[model samples]
Target: MDVTVVGAGPVGLVLAAELALSGAAVQVLERRADPDEAMKAQSINVPTAEALDRRGLLPAAEQVQRELLERVGSFAGAADDRPPGAGRPAPERRFTGHFAGMVLSPDLVDWSDPDLAAHAAVDGARMVPQPQLEALLADHIARLGVPVRRGVEVTALEDTGDGVRVDTTAGTVRTGWLVGCDGGHSTVRRLAGIDFPGTDPELTGYQAVVDIADPEKLAGGWTWSTRGAYRYGPQPGRVATLEFDGPPAGLPHARLRSRGGTPMAPVTLEEVQTSLRRISGADVTLTALRAAPTRWTDNTRQAAAYRSGRVLLAGDAAHVHPPFGGQGLNLGVGDAMNLGWKLGAVVAGWAPEGLLDTYDAERRPLGAWVLDWTRAQIGVLRGDAKSAALREVVADLLSTRDGTTYAVKKISGVTQRIDLPGDHPLVGRFVPDVWLRDGSRLVDHGHDGGFLLLDRTPDGAFARLAAAWAGRVSSVSDDHATPTGVLVRPDGVVAWASDTTDIAAITGLEAALHRWTGAQTSSPAHEPVS
Candidate 1:
């Protein structure tokens, strides 16, 4: 196999699909016996939605997700106490994410800015369950003929000079590269000998579905106490409680063991009762426990290095943080996107030196930023008087126009800029999903997983030069835009753009192509004259 991807979750499936689409032989190994029905994160941020749309999977995702949205009423993160239709038609309904306990609302952002909307690309959020996302990706990879094998646990890995030898429960397999997308406790990450370093848990969080004897006594929103914070509903029968008292002593783990669970135990109704009693001094009784309660912590850590020889890491295997703002899946998806095409290029023998290294260079900083973003929130949500004051101030700031826009940009990842070599402001930015005169979109041209050239010059020289790269690059005639042409990479980043598609512009485009995709053999008919 060209690539052996461990963990058939969204990240691994995405990488596999990209590699397979690019003509690489890929296989995915998963430890899970089957798909999980438990709904984990339901919030999909704008950037992740846009990434899916770029790959032509968003339509399918939306087809399933739209029904969920309509059924659930899609009012997550909106003001609960709105004065009955106060705002102007709700401005396309961007979902609310939070920095800490403070909610980051769509209403806070100015969606009218053309540049912001252009950067948004797909222009919405998705609220799909974890299983749905995994299923969607699984179906996509299946369509692409990428095989995903389940009930296979990778126990060990050895990176030979030329390839990686993976030893699983089933058997040993040799592959050119390996990627670990397994969850926070990643077996592949441990086997590859990567050091995971970061802060420890500050608090313990509990969540469960229960039958409350007195549901009316419990507030239906987030509440802060001396011990910690908790949120009761938006979901009836579901309760989430947090405690900053300390790490679990033994009760939580013991309950999990009694129920035949693992060390990172599932919370019990008794545990929830104890936590709530201690934190809120509430004597609310439970009629029945419908589901097993689960325990988590704000335990944060990230791998010291994403790559070690031919073995790499993505998703929770690379970084793990508190589930603040629904960033884990989104961050992982971004990692897969950044690494997939680069890996495909390397395997296809067109990648320049140091191309793969950019994965760590680009993604590591973003991971660190996310870690700090969550940490900042954790600090203010500390359930203290000082922290409460700080939260109030920060919440007020987040409600301001500039503050809201800044938060939106950071959370949505729309303003994310890379530092590629170019004087054009959009050089390191994602290329807009520019609509052409032909009734097609710029994103449509990227479906083949190739670089796109939007040529609108009087002479067709730029288009001819683009043809020199053939399968590595594609061109579309856009007799519309201001710049003579725009060069977009397979990942939808603007590699080069010019005011005019002259001889000079063609020379620059070729150089840019060489910089991004390496040198291609030129034919006499397409080669530019110096």
Candidate 2:
């Protein structure tokens, strides 16, 4: 096998599908008999969608649902004028207005840009159930003719210098590479001796998907407090969640569904029902419920190395943090997408082993930032005096267009620009969608799994470099002079740029390629004439 993926969950499945699509012979091993129950993580962020769009998987994921705007249930703003007859008897208000909570906007790169639109459409995040996502990814992998071994567990792994020898419950298999997409408590991480140092689960939240006759009437965000215990939920539909500080004795482990393993007692549906009734005046019937332990961690820990010889780690196996901004699944899928092309390239013998090292360098810092921001959010939810003050200040600042725009950028992940310093606008920024005069778009540059140069003019340097690299690089030059020429990496970051006709003024294209791709080619002595 070209690659062996552990744990056939959504992350593993997506990674397998991506690798298989890249034309790699992939095999997936799972401990579970089949897909498990849908528990958490239903919302996909804008960056996640953009990442999927680059791989052409967004459409299939979007088949389930479209973008979901954040809703505010009961928090009100300070309007100058009060409601009519405020002095008299007033109607009871359960919650306030819609503009209270945070809003994550769409990606910065517009879909209308012809070059980018054709390559990838900028669809906002989709809200699909986790189980559905897993099933779809698994089906996509099967369609690609990749072998998926269910009900099999990887017992041991031994690096054979050339490849990895995997021992599983079903049978023994050999592969050039291994990726662990397994969730927290990951067996792969343990086998690899990776340490997951992070904060303990101080807060526990209860989530339930219940059938409500008047779901529409109960829609919006909610934050209710009872005896200092906070339960916030009813995020715009029938799904209601209750989050509270864990009891001093700790929560009793109760299995709400078969998906989450069995645990100790003290937790039950009756207790959840009582809590819901106390929180909300309505007597809501319970359909399904599960408890999720939220932990605060660095979110930056990797295997010290992504590849220990031939074994690698991706998704939850690589990093774990609170699911605060709906980033866990997205982060995992991103890990898959980033590794898929490189794994394919290495397997095909185009890229050297050193290319894999970039994964940790680029992604670890980004992961740490995400963790820091999410921890700040958790602090706000915990009602820390400083965090509360900060929220108030932020809310006041958000009254302005610029402030709101900044807030949106921060939460949406569009602001996450990779630091690749150069003259080109596209470098360090996501490749913006370009509207070609011919009316075609070029969003899926990663389809071929190589570096792409979008030259606005007839720059011979880019063409020459592409010709020299052959199958290892791709270059496209449009007749029209777009604002700037963009160089996109296999993972979709703009690696190089040439804003003007002076393509030779900057470092040679060969040097840029070698730097970005970790290629060992000699740098061209003379810059080609534009």
RMSD of each: 4.4, 8.4
The TM-score measured for candidate 2 stands at 0.78
Per-residue lDDT of 1-530 in model 1, one digit per residue for the tens?
99999888788988898888778899999876776444345567666777777778766765555555454344244333333223322444456566775666677687766556675445433665566888888888899999889888887889996999999989999999999988777778888889988887767777676788877777766788888887775545767777886657654311111211123544567888777667666888876666656566677788999999999999888987777667877888888888888899888888853788999998898898888887887888887788889998998999897888788777777776677777776787777657888787877877767788888887767788777677788788878457778898766678898886567777788789788867665662474558
Off by over 4 Å in 2: 66-121, 212-219, 226-237, 240-242, 247-268, 271-275, 278-283, 287-305, 383-390, 444-446, 459-461, 503-507, 517-530
For candidate 1, give the lDDT of residue 447. 79
Best by lDDT: 1
Would you list the clashing residue pairs of candidate 1? 267-293
Give the alpha carbon lDDT tens digit for every residue of 397-510 in model 2: 666655655554455455566666576656776666665656655565555456677767554545555555555567676774655466777667777777565546334555
Off by over 4 Å in 1: 74-92, 208-213, 235-238, 250-263, 267-281, 284-294, 521-529
List TM-score per model, in order: 0.89, 0.78
Q: TM-score winner among the candidates?
A: 1
Q: State the TM-score for model 1.
A: 0.89
